[model samples]
Target: MQAVILAGGKGKRLAPYTTILPKPLMPIDDMPILEIVLLQLKKHGFTNIVLAVGHLAGLIQAYCGDGSRWGLNITYSMENEPLGTAGPLSLIDGLEENFLVMNGDLLTNIDYSDLMKLHLEKNALATVSMYNKDVPISLGVLNLDDSGNIIDYIEKPTLTYKVSMGIYILNRKILDHIEKGKYLDFPVLIKQLIEENEKVVGYDFTGYWMDIGRHEDYSKVLEEFNSIRDELL
Candidate 1:
């Protein structure tokens, strides 16, 4: 199977570190996050990989030359301008079947084989990997009626949502929704699919997953990596 990893983002949220290296190259222990992702994919039998790169593309290419160390083949898709998330797919070639597309900075224990199995079984146009996230409200919350009277009140309640893990298994036909050189994001593409009555499945994963897009997440993953290294590798 083939995989496309979106590693082009400037990662402004992780500024100081990203100033030197791309977010995908940021170390989680001694290994770059993307290296971990590649090793995991290689373990799962994905040999052909495409790295979508922009900011500091040279450094990434230098670090992961040919993917020979992991026994995988890698190709680079250069983005001259920011193409959002989904737009980069339009620039790649030979995606005739279903492929896995994910953000490069992810740290997760998701089984790629299981995700592909579900995608095939459902015959979905796109299968999104979802993670349950609980966001806590630090302040008091209130519910109001139509007349603006408070019907209920609560304090520091946590809201749970099945959020995108920034991972997807998409059929090649999904590429039709993306325009060449357009800044199309995943949410917009998914919304377009929904409006067009396309089947978009969400596979709920309760395993460990983190985006590692921020400084705090980087630190958290660094602290957690050792314990989960065996599982992720």
Candidate 2:
């Protein structure tokens, strides 16, 4: 199978580190995070890979060149301007089949083969990998009525939600929804697909997943990557 990795974000939240290296090039146990992702995809039989790059694209290309070392064929899709996530896919050629698309900075042990299998089984136009996330509120949450009076109050509630894991299996047909040279994110595209009565499925994953887009997440992955290296690699 083919896979497209989005590696072009400016990574403003990662600041200084990203200033020199793209977020995907950031190290996790001496290996660039994107390298780890590539290795995992290779292990899962995804031999054709495309990196959609913009910020610091040269460095990523220089480092990953042809993906020969990883036993994969690598190509690049350059985005002259920042294309919000899914927008870059429109610029990639030869996507005439179902393929995988994921963020370059993600750290996860998700089973890509299984995800693709489910997508094919369901015949979905798009299959998003979903992760269960718990967001903790530090302050008390208040509920108010239209009269501005307090209706209910709760302290430090933990909200649970199913969020996109930034990994997806998309059918070539979905490319019809994308406009060339326009910035389009996954959420907006997914919403449009739903509005048009397209089939979009979600595969729930309760395994390790981290988007190392921020300093805190990057630090956390650095601290824990070693323990889970076997699972990922």
Candidate 3:
């Protein structure tokens, strides 16, 4: 199977640390987060990998040269300018009929093979890996009816939403919706697909997952890594 890791982001949210190293290169425990991602993909039987790189691309290329160390065939797709999220897919060549795409800064134990299996089983143009996230509201939320009448109130309630995990399985045909040399985020691309009545689906995952792009999340990973290291690696 083939996989494309989006490792090009400037990671402005991660400032000073990202000022020195790209988000994918940021260390987790013993190695960079991107290394862990590669290991997981390889374990799931994805040998052909393409790293869509920019923003300190040289460092990533040097550190992961050829991917021979991990018994994977790794290639690069350099972005001279920012390509948002899905735009970089246009820059990559020779993508398989269906391939996996994901952000490189994530730490998760998701089964990539299973994700692909679901995509194939459903014959979907795109499959988004989803996680149900519970967001707590500190203040009360109100429901209003027509004419601005307050209908119901829930005090400091929690809301659950199925959210994209920045991981996806996309068929080659889906690329037709994306234009080359343009900035297109994933959300806009998905919306366009829906507007066109393309077959897009979601794979719900209830496993351990975290995006360590913020300082607080990074700190949480540091605190919890040792406990979940076995599950992740």
Candidate 4:
């Protein structure tokens, strides 16, 4: 099978650290986060991998070096300009009838094969892997009536949402919707597909998944890596 790892962004949110090192190259423990992702993909039976890279491209290429150490065929798709997310897909070639795409700076125990299986079984144009995230509201929330009356008051509470894990399995045909050389984010592409009645679906995953795109998340991964090392690796 094939997989595309999006590693191009400048990782503005990650700032000074990213100012010198690409987010994917950030160390999770001993290995770079991208290395972990590559290993996981290899374990899941993906032989061919394409790294969609832009910012700090040289550093990433130097580190990965054709993916030989990991026993995977790695190639790169460089972005001359910043393509939001899905836009980079337009630059990749020879994608399988179906392929997996994911952000490079994440730690997850999701079964990539299973997610692909669900996509195939459902015959979807795209299948998004979702995780149930509990977002805690620190401030009191209010519900007001149309007449400017206080209808309900709720103290700080936790809200649950099925958030995208930044992982996806997409059908090659879906590429028809993407314009080559245009900047298009993944969410916008998915939303367009849904509006057009395409077979876009979601696969809920109850597993450990976190994107280390922020300092806090990066710190959390460092703290949690050892304990969940077995599960993730």
Candidate 5:
């Protein structure tokens, strides 16, 4: 099987650590974040991997050459410029059936085999991994009327939302919705797929998952690494 990993972040939020080493190279437990992701791919019997790289692309290439050290064959899809989430996908060749794609910096214990099986069984055009998050309102929330007046109100209403875990299983046909090389975020791609009557399913993963985009998130993962090492790493 094949997989695509997005590792081209500038990582402005996790500066300094990302100033020299890219976010993917940031250490997680005994290995780099990208290495852990590579290990996960290997565990799922995916030997062909593509890293869509930019920012400090060379360093990642130097460290993960051919992916043999990790028992996988790694290729690169160089982003000539910043191509958001789905943009770089245009560069990948020969993904006929279905393929796995995730950010290089994500940490999760989702069983990839199961996710893929669901994708094929349901015949979804795309499948997204989702995480549940509850966000409490800092201010009073009001149930509004068609008029500019509020019908009812609740103080500090907590809102729950299902957020994208940034992992996806995409059928090759979905590429028809993508404008090649554009800066397309995953959500925008989803909207297009939905409008076109394409099936998009979500697989809920309640395991330890981290999107190490900011300093706080990065630090938190490091602190929890020891406790959840076996699960996330």
Candidate 6:
């Protein structure tokens, strides 16, 4: 199986650290985040991989060349400038069928093989790995009237939403939805697909999934890794 890693982002939210190194190259435990991702994909029999890199591309290229050390075949798809998540995908070549695609700065125990199986069974053009997120409103949110008067108030409302896990199983045909040489983000791509009457399935993975896009997520990784190292992986 082949995997595409969207590692082009500057990760501005993870600044200071990202200023010196690519977010994917940031050390997580004993190894870089990209290394962890490669290991996980390798474990699941995904030997062919692509690293879509932009900022600090040289560092990543120097670090993981041909992916031979991991017993995987790695290739590089360099973006001249930062291409949005789905945009750089258009630059990749030789993707036969459905393959794994994910953000580089994520740590998760999602059963990728199972996700692929479900994607095939559902015959979907795209399958999104999803996580359930609860964004709580700490203050009472009021529904304002036409004149800006409060009509109702809900206190400490915890809204549960199924959000994207920055991971996906995408069929190659979906590339048709992408405009060439443009910034095409995931949400806009998915929205367009839905509007065009395409099937996009969601593979719910509520298991240990941490998006190390921010400091808190990085902290959680260390905490979770300590207690459930074997299982958390």
**Top lDDT model:** 3
CA lDDT, candidate 2, residue 207: 93
Q: Report the C-alpha lDDT of model 2 over 35-67, residue by residue, as the tens digit.
A: 999999998989999999999999999999999
TM value for model 4: 0.97
lDDT of 6 by residue, 70-148 (tens): 8999999989987799999889989869999999998888888889899999999999998999999899888998999
For model 3, where is the 10-residue window of minimal lDDT?
173-182
Model 3: per-residue lDDT, tens digit, 1-233? 99999999999989999987999999988999999999999999999999999999999999999999999999999999999999999988899999999999999999999999999999999999999999999999999998999999999999999999999999999779899979999999999999999999999999999998899998998889999999987
**TM-score preference between candidates 4 and 5, better one:** 4
Backbone atom clashes (below 3 Å) for every candidate: 0, 0, 0, 0, 0, 0
Model 5: runs farther than 4 Å from truth?
A: 144-153
The runs of at least 3 residues in candidate 1 whose Cα sits more than 4 Å from the true structure, single-residue gaps closed, are none
Please give, for residues 121-170, the per-residue lDDT of candidate 4 as tens digits.
Answer: 99999999999999999999999999989988899989999999999999
TM-score of 3: 0.97
Q: 1-233 in candidate 5: lDDT tens per residue?
A: 88999999788888877889989999987889889889888888778899999999999999999998888989998888998989999877877578999998888888888889899998998999999988999998888889879899899888999999999999998888888888888988899888888899999878778879988888898888888777754
What TM-score would each prediction reach against the true structure?
A: 0.98, 0.95, 0.97, 0.97, 0.93, 0.93
lDDT of each: 0.94, 0.94, 0.96, 0.95, 0.88, 0.89
Look at candidate 4 and tell me the lDDT of residue 153.
89
TM-score of 6: 0.93
Residue 15's lDDT within candidate 1 is: 93
Worst 10 residues of 6 by lDDT: 224-233
**Residue 90 C-alpha lDDT in model 6:** 89
